[model samples]
Target chain A: MRKYLFIYKSEIMSELQYVFNILIGFIGYVIILFIFLNLWKYIYNDPNELINGYNMNQMIWYVIITEILWSSLGGRKLCRKICDDVRGGNIAYNINKPYSYIGYSLFSHLGSATIRGILYIILGMILGFIFLGSFPNLNILSILAVLLSGILATIISTLLIIFIGLLAFIIEDSNPFYWLYSKAMLVLGTIFPIEYFPKVMQTILKYSPIYVVSYGPAKLFVEFSWPNFITIIFWQLIYILIAYGLCAILYKKGVKNLNVNGG
Target chain B: MLMVVKNQLKISWLSIKYALIREMLNKTTFLTNIIFMVLNNASFIVQWIILYSLKDNVGGYTFKQVLLLWGIASGTYGVAHFFFKKAFSLSDTINTGKLDSYLVQPKNVLISAITTDIDTSALGDMIYAYITLFIYGVTLPNFLLFTFFCIIGGIFLTSISIILSSLSFWFSKSDIIADTGNGLMTNFATYPDGIFKGIVKILLFTLIPVGIVNYIPVRVMVSFNLGSFLIVIMATIFIVILAFLVFYKGLKKYSSSNLMMAKI
Candidate 1:
């Protein structure tokens, strides 16, 4: 455990070495936020008006929070790492390691997520202040609930991404799938709140793990109602269990076929 | 001149035929391409629905006009993919050093790279757009002209795709750049050209050149003026020529690998 913690620290230290890149990434995030804000302006068209159950202020606030959440997800970076490891024959090294593959993957993911999450949170809070004039309500219990749910959301997201990324092991070329899925998520994840989806779609998306990553957190950040909070936590736990089971089966199968070539 | 024109048509036809066959036979590649097309169209529908729910039109565009915009965007995207799908995958080729193989080919590397990897799934979107346009655009006054300019717009889109792919040689990462180009293209092309004024119009016309794809042509078709129509055609030719120059200039920077390295 201590060794893994050390590994996580070194990994973070290495990431911090590239301070400029992180700053530039934050700038890019702000630009995207600007574009999305403009889009909402067009969507609203009238001052202080509401569209689709959300007021202009609420809509802008929603966009800001979602952008922050979206940036933190970082599924693309995780997907790229998995594909690179598989393609570059580094999966064999991972297999030889002492810890379970999934454990190692999750830890490393947590480290990367930590850095991105901080940047996103700080930037999001500042942007939220500028946009909303203050933070949303955050009682002690609700704050605790959000922290717990956020962790669960991150786990579910990471595991789901790992499952998708593992397709690289099975398919000769999975680049197109990765690109298509990520882009689809980017557009679909933002356009409509999943709750606004038709009843049937909402039900289907509730089970599909992608919704948990984006919509669940977006809702929590906005409303933070008790029933909504408990529901997401319950679903997230269920997803994590399912993800663990799939990862175990696949990792065992993948390891058996793993062949290490030139480093 | 007649002979030259005839030869060009024959060559282009033959290339299209072969490309179509290659795409149809490759099941995985074909399916992958179709999935992206479906996702893109689905997202557009969602946006359209949202807009309709809000009002009859967005920024003076009627329901039919919105459909027309979708038809135009999807049709041009499909046409571009049919001719230059390989442009979308240029990042992988460059990153993996597979571009060396294209550079070493004796033929025009830009044409060779793009045509060799045809994406026929774009055919699905093309069919969808054609049906939608036929159904919706048939009611418009300038129906025939709209169809004619759609073809020209498609050609311009193909030119843009090729040019964007060629940019991979100059930039280490073209995926983001290509994505940015597509975003800008969709946002600009879907709107009626009249909404943009002054410097923005000039920027789209000269710098971005997205105006050549759907905007300028659609605007001309609506106006029903011979001079505006002629200008649209001239703009398309200019953009295509400029794209050709960009590709050739970038080709000088493209490096290729030999047979031994291609052994995967």
Candidate 2:
């Protein structure tokens, strides 16, 4: 635990040096969010119109929050590192390290994600203010709750992406699965709320990662309620455990067939 | 003059043909790449489907009109990616001195460099575009307009990429600008034009140029207008010429070894 803490601390400092790089990457988020803001503005004909119990303010805020969480987590690079480690035989070197491979990867990436997430939040607030002219109303309790949910959401996504990367041991390419997972995240909860989905999909997605990973934190931020927070955080906890177990299982099994090419 | 034009076209055709053949060497991978990309893109449409279910109109677009927006976007993106995929990587090529090999070639350097590689997955985007067009409803005139716009949009995208990537000659790590610029163009192109107004809309046309890529062309397809079509043509020509000018001007700064490119 202490060693993981060291990694977490060090990785934050290391990732901080790449602030310029991260800012450049934020360009995509800025564009996508701007487009969504425009889309939502054009959808809600009346400024006070409500669709599925969300007002114009909440709807735009929903996009801002989801995009912040998704981009900050840096799900793409997380999987690539894992995928490359598993496929490129770097796992052979990784397993012999002092601590758990999963712990090391999780904490280090989390450190990086923490820096990126903070930046995204600041940017989101500024963008939100400019685009919508108002912020979502939340108290101190709601703010803390949403922050907790966001952390849990990041953990769940990280564990799942690690699990996907470890799949390179079993499959020719784990990229396709990663692609499917990202699209599922993007389409289901990131683009819009689960309520916007068909009733059937809404029910199914509630039990899926869409509930914990992408939708949960944003929902909390937009419409923070005690029941919603409890439900989302509980599911997030369960999904993170499940994701962790999957990675442990895959890693234990996968290390057997690992091959190293060079001397 | 005519002979030079014909020869350049022949060269581009051969370059694309060979790139395609190289990609097809792995049959299963090639097929799966196309298939998977189509599926990947189709998933985004689900968002629109869900949105339209609750509302009759969004951003002044009917459901079908929105699909046309998507179709034009898809078609243009596919054409650009499939035909000039290397333009997207022009910064990397410049950074890594990948230009050395192309510089030695007998044909045009920019053309040879950009048309050398093909993204097989882009074939899926092309297939998806046509599927959406068919779903929207087809007419001979509409079909012709769509095809023309695809070419126009592809050229526009390629030029944008080239112009952005050419910045690598003057600066380190300029791929960031190229990538972000390209992303802005592609992302904005798929969106409904009515949603944007005032300065942002103006920026899209003049600075980002996504308006020229899809919006105007989509207008021509939905309701044929000579004026809009001519703007598309004129803008595309101006952008392409600008791309050439930028690349050539930057080429004078090219040294065979850039420290950044040598980083592996």
Candidate 3:
């Protein structure tokens, strides 16, 4: 635990050095948010018209919350690191270390993300306020639920990314897999709610990782309900087990294969 | 002057040829990248389709017009990345002093630098663009006009990247600035311009130039406007010349990394 804390602290300190870069990166997010604001405004035509059960304000805020979750998770960078390590034979060096590689990855990523996530959320909320004239109405309990679900979503996202990276054991590059997964999340979950998808896709996506990783937190934030919270928590628990179980199996098999090849 | 231009063209052609061959060395990865990129880009269209199903038009853009907008955007991006991918990464090349290789070579440094690599996935964008056009009803004139506009838009996009990246001459970490600028261009290029009004619309035309890249092209293609077509051509030429001037001016401040490397 202490070792992991040290790793986390180190990552946060290093990330802090590039504060300007962090801010610059947010420019893209802001521009996309601006476009969405205008787009939803144009689409609504009437202020009171509800599209897919969401008012224009709710729709834009939904996009904001989901984008925040997506950006702050740092799954792409983590997945790239794992893919590079496995492909470059650097994973062999880490396997002999005292700490669990998966734990190290998770803690370090979360530590780096903690600062970034907070900054992004604050920026996103400011943008939301500026565009929509207010923030989402939420009680303290609902906000707490959103935060908890967000953390679980981040973990599940990171685990799934690690699973994709582990595919390097079989394939030469795992980026294509990551690309497909990310597009699914972006199209199905982040940019629009599942309700906005086709009826068939909505049903399928509800059972997929997109439901837990992105939709759950954003959905709870916009319109909190006990039934939805319970459902999301149940999905999160299942995804956690599946992600962990898959990673363990793949990591063991991958390391053994690497050893046999004298890597 | 003609002789110089001819020599530079030959050198650029050779650089591109070698880059393509190098990429082809990993044929499987190349094909996978192209295929997956097409699939990824197609997913965005699916989202738009869903949106269109709910409404007749977005910002006065019918579903078919939206298809043309994407076709132009993806096609222009394809031309830039497929031919001169290093234009986007020019800041890193300048900051890290990787420009040393081009300097040592006896060719047009800017041309050589940007033409030295091919992003295979952009080929997918090119194919996807043409497919979208075919779906939008391909006529002989429409096909020719679309291809011409794509070339103009591609040049404009690359010029924007070059102008932004040339800031590395004065700033230490201008790469981030360049990236943000490029991101803005890409984000704005995809959306219908009718939604933006007043100052934002003006800025899009002058500063970011997404208007020339997509909006002007889309409008010209739809209505055959001679005035707008000429404006796009002139803007593209002006930007290209400006990019050259900025890059050469910055070359005076470029210091070498002193690390020995070779262009493959």
Candidate 4:
């Protein structure tokens, strides 16, 4: 735990050096948010009308919250690092280190993301207020729920990326897998609520990672309810177990293959 | 002048040829990238389909017109990346002094730098663009016009990247600015222009040029407007000349890295 904390602390310190890069990266999201704000305004045609059970403000805020999760999760960086480690045979060196590679990766990512996530949330809120005139009407309890769910979703997202990266042990590259996973999250989760999807896809996606990873936190933030909160937590637990179990099995087998190959 | 243009075109062809061969060496990864990119792009179209299902039009764009908008966007992006992928990363090349290779070579530096690589997945985008066009109903004349606009749009997009990246000549770490500019152009190109108004619309046309890259192309494709089509052509020529001027002007300030690197 102490070693992981050290790793986390180091990452946070290093990331602070690139504060401008981090902020500039958010420009794309801001542009997209502005487009969505105008788009929903035009679509809704009336501020009071609810097209898909969400008023204009609620709809735009939903996008803001989900997009924040999307950008702050650090899934792409995690996947690329793991992929590089495996492909470049650096994982063998990492295995010899005092700390577990998985723990170091997870903690370092979380530490760096902690700072960026806060900044992103602040930016999202600023954009929200600029376009919609106010923030989401959330009390302390709901904010707490959203934060907890966001952390879990981040974990699940990171685990999924690691699992994809582990495929580098067998394949030449695992970026294509990350590509598909990100597109799934982007189209199904971030851009629109599940309600906006086709009825069939919505039903199926409810049980998929989109629910726990992207939709759950944003949904709870916009319209909090006890049943939805409990359901999200339950799904997150199941996803956690699945991601962890698969990663453990894959890592074991992958390392064995590497050893047999004299890597 | 004719001899110089011919030599540059030959060099560009060779560069693209080598880049494609290098990528094809890893056949499985190459195929996987292209196939998955098509699927990924398809997912966005699905989102648009769902949205159109809810309403008749968005920003006065019918579903079919939206299809054309996406077709132009994807096709233009494909042409830029598939043939000149390194244009998108020109800032990194300049900042790291990788321009040394192109400078040492006896060719147009900007063209040589941009043509030295291909993004295999962008081929998928090109194919997907045509698929979208086919679904929108393809006639011979319309197909030719779309292809023409895609070339213009591709040049326009690459010019924007070059202009932004050329700023690396002045600033130490301007890659982020280039990236932001590129991102804004890409993001704005997919949406309907009618949604934006006033200052935002003006900025889109002047600074980002998403209007010339995408919106105008879609407009010309939807209805045969001779005036708008001519504007797209003229703007493409103007941007290409401007990109060349900026890149060469910046080249005067380039300090070679002297690092031994070769374009594989």
Candidate 5:
């Protein structure tokens, strides 16, 4: 485990050497931040009119939290990378190594995700301060819930990515799947809150793991309840266990073919 | 020039057929596209329901009026996707060094590149939009005139797509521009143009230019304004000509070596 920790750290250090690329990525995030801020600002032009349960400030806070949660734990690109590796024969090299392939991927993904999480949180903090001025009377328990949700969001995202990436072994050009999945994230990830959805869609979303990742956590941070908080944590554990089962099944099936293409 | 166009059309047809066949055979692409189309339309339908619940008209558009606008816009976007998906993926082609193959082709490079990856899945959106339009009880146009407008709409949209895509040659990456352009168009196109005021309205007419795709024709169709429709036709011709000139000019600085077209 210590050795793998070193590997993960070393891998991240090398990637950090591409400082320019990381900076470019940060610029991309900033652009999205600006777009969302403007969009919300337009919607909240008159905060006095109470639309739904919350005012403009609260609604925009939802936008901020959702955006941060998404940026931090959205592992779509990492999934694509995993798919690329599986299809491109890079996974074969890892399989021949001493550690488990899933373990290696998890570590590598963690290293990168830690960086993204930090970047997203710091950016969100700055934006929140600039716009909302410090905290909005958020409690310590709510803060803890937010942190727990963030961790679960990361796990759910990583597991979902790993599952989809494994599809590359069975298919040609996993991009079509990746593209559709990413779009699904737009709906599922609270780019528009699930409340905006129709009754049927709301029902479907309630049970979807996506809700736990984005909606559950964001809701907790904004409106705290001990029962709902415990419920979300329970769902997270359930999802994690299911994800582990899926990983084991998919890896075994994918390895049976063992026909990795490209170098 | 006439001969160049004729030959380009012929080659584009062949490439389109080949791509359609490839996509049809590829179950993954076909199924994924189908799911995406359904989900996209579903989201729009949900949004419309919410908006319709609040009021009969949003920004001066009746429910059916907005549906007509969406029908035209989404149908036009669908057709664009159906035939010119490769052009839409210009950044990918450029980044992956796949542009070399298109460059080597005997046909117009842009036409060939665009026709090569036809997205037939867009047909679903086209069908859905038109069906909705029909269900809304829009009066039937003279068949010949409707056909003429459809052709003009296709060309106008293609011109806009080409101009947007050609920016990739000048920039390191143009995906963000493409995405932003598409997002803005999709968001704004649902509402009537009359809602937008001042600089934004003017910007939509000029800079974004999505107004050319659905707004003008649908407006004319609804009001039966011959003058406006004719103006739209003329504008379509002007833009297509402009797109060609700009693309060819950009080709001059192409520098088609391995360095410019870096392999992914």
Candidate 6:
């Protein structure tokens, strides 16, 4: 645990050099948000009107939060990195390393994401305030819970993505798999709240990882309730464990298949 | 001058052909790349399908019109990436002095610099574009018009990337601008133009130019009109010319900063 924390801290220190790299991503996020803001305005003739229990502001804010998370977590960086390491045979050097590769990936990614996420969070906040005023009604406790859930959401997403990255052991490239996963999240929850989806589809998505990975915190931010908070947090916790366990199993099997050539 | 233009076009075509032949060496990778791209695009359209299910229209676009807009967007993207993948990477070329090789080449520098590789996945985008067009309802005339728009949109999109990416000649680390420019063009082109208002709408028509790339083309597809068609043609020519102008002008400031890496 201490070694992981040290790795995480050192990675953050090293990641500060790439602040400009992350901040530039803000422009892409702003454009997406701006486009959505306009689309929502056109959708709801009245700003006060509600669709599936969300007003224009709620819808817009939902997009902001989800976009921030989506942009911050990135779609497939870790998976691609893992695939590269595995395919390029660089993972063999770490075969006897003191630290576990999965732990290193998770920490290093979080380390970098910590910087990028905070900036995007700030950007998302400012953009939300600028485009739609203050966030939809939320108390301090709910806000804290939402933040906690957001962190958990990132963890689960990271672990799952790392698991996909580990697929470099068996399959060729994990990118094709990641495309499907990311697109599901994008259309299902990141771009639009599940409420806009049909009733039957909504129920399935609610139970799916998209709910815990994306919709949960954003939904809580827009509309806060204790019951929803408990359910989202509980599911987020479960998914994190499930995702991490999957990554560990995959990494173990992948390492066994690891063949290194050229000393 | 006409002969020179034809020769340059021939050279560009040859460069692209050779690039395709090289990619053909890896048949499975190339085919998978194209297929995955199509699947990626199909996944995104599902968002609109869900949205359209709830609303009859979005941003002055009917479901069918949305399909047209998306089709043209994908077509333009396919054209740009498949043919001129380096246009998006022009800033890197200029910054790292990769442009030096093209400068020394006898052929047109911009054409040579851009046509060195193809993004095989963009071929999938091309396939997806036609799929959407066919689904939207295809006539012989409609098919011809769609092909024209895709060809023009491809050139226009490439020119947009080149013009933005050429900024590296005057500024250090301007790759972000180029990347954001590319992202803006690709992302905004997919959305309906009617939703954008005020300065953003104007900007989309002018600077970012998704309006010219997909919006106007989609309109022409919906209802054929000579004036609009001519505008598309003229706007495309203008953008292509403007791209050449910007790149050449920036070239004056370009200095070779190659770091001893041999391309050979």
Docking class of 1: acceptable
Better of 3 and 5 by lDDT: 3
Model 3 / residue B9 / CA error / Å: 1.7
* TM-score: model 4 vs. ground truth: 0.96
Between 3 and 4, whose lDDT is larger?
Answer: 3
Error (Å) of candidate 4 at residue A90 is 1.3
Tell me the docking grade of candidate 5: incorrect
Number of the top-ranking candidate, with DockQ as the measure: 4
lDDT of 2: 0.86
Give lDDT tens digits, candidate 6, residues A76-117: 878889889988898987778899888888988888888888
Candidate 6 ranges beyond 4 A from true positions: B1-7, B261-264
Give the TM-score, chain B only, in order for the candidates.
0.75, 0.94, 0.97, 0.97, 0.85, 0.95
Clashing pairs in 6: none
Docking class of 6: medium
Clashing pairs in 5: none
Every candidate's fraction of true contacts kept comes to 0.13, 0.69, 0.78, 0.82, 0.09, 0.71
**B1-264 per-residue lDDT for model 1 (tens digits):** 787667655555577788777666757757766765565565556656655676665655666676776677677777777766776666556556676666655555556556555666677667667666775656555666666666777677767666776677788767556656655776566555444556766977877776666665555544567787787788789878987898788767766543356321
Q: Which structure is stronger by TM-score: 1 or 6? A: 6
Better of 3 and 5 by TM-score: 3
Preferred candidate (lDDT higher): 1 or 5: 5
Quote each prediction's TM-score. Answer: 0.74, 0.93, 0.96, 0.96, 0.79, 0.95
User: Can you give the lDDT of residue A178 in candidate 1?
Assistant: 63
Pairs with backbone N, CA or C atoms under 3 Å apart (clashes), candidate 3: none
Question: What lDDT score is found at residue A37 in candidate 1?
Answer: 57
Q: Which whole-number lDDT from 0 to 100 does residue B199 have in model 2?
A: 98
Off by over 4 Å in 2: B1-15, B25-28, B258-264
> How high is the lDDT of residue B112 in model 6?
87
Q: List, for all models, the DockQ compared with the true complex.
A: 0.24, 0.67, 0.77, 0.78, 0.20, 0.69
